[model samples]
Target: MLPDISVVLTTYNQGKFIKKAIDSILSQSFNNFELIIVDDGSIDDTKRKIDQYSDSRIKKVFKQNEGPSSASNVGISLAKGAWIALMSGDDISLPDRLQVQYEFANSFNYKICFGLPIIIDDEDNIIPDEDFPVFFSDHSFSNRKVFKRLFEKGNYFCAPTAFFQKDIIEEKNPFLISSLQLQDFACWLSLSKKYDMPIINKRLIKYRRHANNISSKNNNGRMEFEMKMIYKNILNNMTWELLHEIFPNQFSVASMNDKRCFEIEKSFLLLKQSIKSVHEVGCEKIWNYINDDVMCSILSTKYNFNYLDFFMETGKFNTNERDESND
Candidate 1:
């Protein structure tokens, strides 16, 4: 029989911190778990450091240099527990972290779970900054509420604090390889679209802050590009029921009753949001949908915006306080 949980710790060249990360899980208050460490082509001493561990609960997979999404997928494929907890190579999980999250998810019957995080530095000192993840609530949210929050506020759920059922990983096969460094955010968006994950009100992980962190937004414009792609993908695939649920009163009740109309009406609200890339993508999507005469007629009849009206609104749109771009 398998362990109660499988901890898939995906590490690259985090040799310096990898031992502490592994030790954190090995010393978890909840010990009925297997730790699978996937070394994603670490050029440093990550492999040699991992070799120091002799714990039977610890398993290892050494592989070539693949991006984060690919490395994580490899680890997910090897998970043997009923539940899976994802830990980054550079961060440290508190001893009670597993116990608290596992119990919380099990008690509430939530398939996916996330915990709060406190940022740490290279010296393992707690850093006081506004960049850390905060869930802002003690209660759980419905899938729709969570989905809407994901779109409006961006990613508040930090990947290091992530925990979920093994079944979800199997069924969804999330963490798109095309998502680049933002696999977690994209996966969260995809999962939250269908499943309700809870944010436990406890601080569980010490998310390390350093120049080498892949989850860093400082990545060479890849973060922004991936985020745009993720948002566009979600909008393109959204059902009207979800769109209507996200924007309750934005669409008239009659429009809500009509799937196509309600779906098209989402572009209007997306265009009004304060996020630049999101609204830009929304504008692009509307233009794409309106090019066909039949869809144009449907949108024109169902909603007030026609081609010229939409053009005027798009022209007047400004997401930022300072509109410096000439485009």
Candidate 2:
């Protein structure tokens, strides 16, 4: 029988946690789903453990070490369900996770659904005193509040807990395999732009934060790289006029910060292009941005102007900052 959903999980050397992760899906209240496990060149007993599972609903894909994004893409390409639910090899979904999300999708005609998640330690124990929600509720991710929050504070939803319509990914061509890093953020940002991101408040998955996990090991580096691309790809695409139209108050500050950051980069580039270009018409464009009361006020408080000073002193923009550069 064709499954109602395709649960795509990418596994590497997660031999220790793979069984528990797979078992969680099998034990789900909603059983009409295919558990698609893509083993991305696991050198450990990860594949051996998967071989032990005899369920007809389980589909396994093997590939060389191409990273999670490529594995997900392969799984997505082979998926045969109406919805594609994403999970990590180390994460565990609650028994009712799919039932709840599936019901939400069917009831509201939602194309994408995500929920809160409990942070787990290496031992698979939930964080101390973390109150996981008992029931699911509505949360609109596309609303200005949610959008602004996501953009300002960074990613909000639990990625492994997300369930998106298959057609959406097929149409958007989600998950760039080349990123090797922050592929989730890149895909999510693309999806967010095209669809109304809806989130459920219930904690439906246990997000494992282990030393061996890709994210845990490269958190800072990956975040910096992702932020740089987000600024260039997402923020740079927005016009100042459009920003004011979409974001009114709280997001206005974020938009101003984005604009200033862009202007600063542009000015630094122009300064490097030629000393004479500093007097060009485009050079004055930077002043126009700085002249904005809100941007100037914010910069007055930010002491890290090394980005601006680099070009002024050395006549070239330094890719490295006192802090790591995002891209």
The lDDT leader among the candidates is 1
Residues 206-284, model 1: lDDT tens digits? 9887846534434535665666687776766676667767777766677657766666767777777666666777788
Q: lDDT at 150 for candidate 1?
A: 75
Screening candidate 1 with a backbone cut-off below 3 angstroms (N, C-alpha, C), the clashing residue pairs are: none
> Model-by-model lDDT, in order?
0.78, 0.69
lDDT of 2 by residue, 79-115 (tens): 9999989999999999999999999888988788888
Quickly count the clashes in candidate 2.
Answer: 1
Best by TM-score: 1
Listed per candidate, the RMSD to the true structure in angstroms reads 3.8, 8.6
Please provide the root mean square deviation of candidate 2 (C-alpha atoms, Å).
8.6
Candidate 2 colliding pairs: 224-326
Model 1 Cα RMSD, Å?
3.8
TM-score for each predicted model, relative to the true structure: 0.87, 0.71
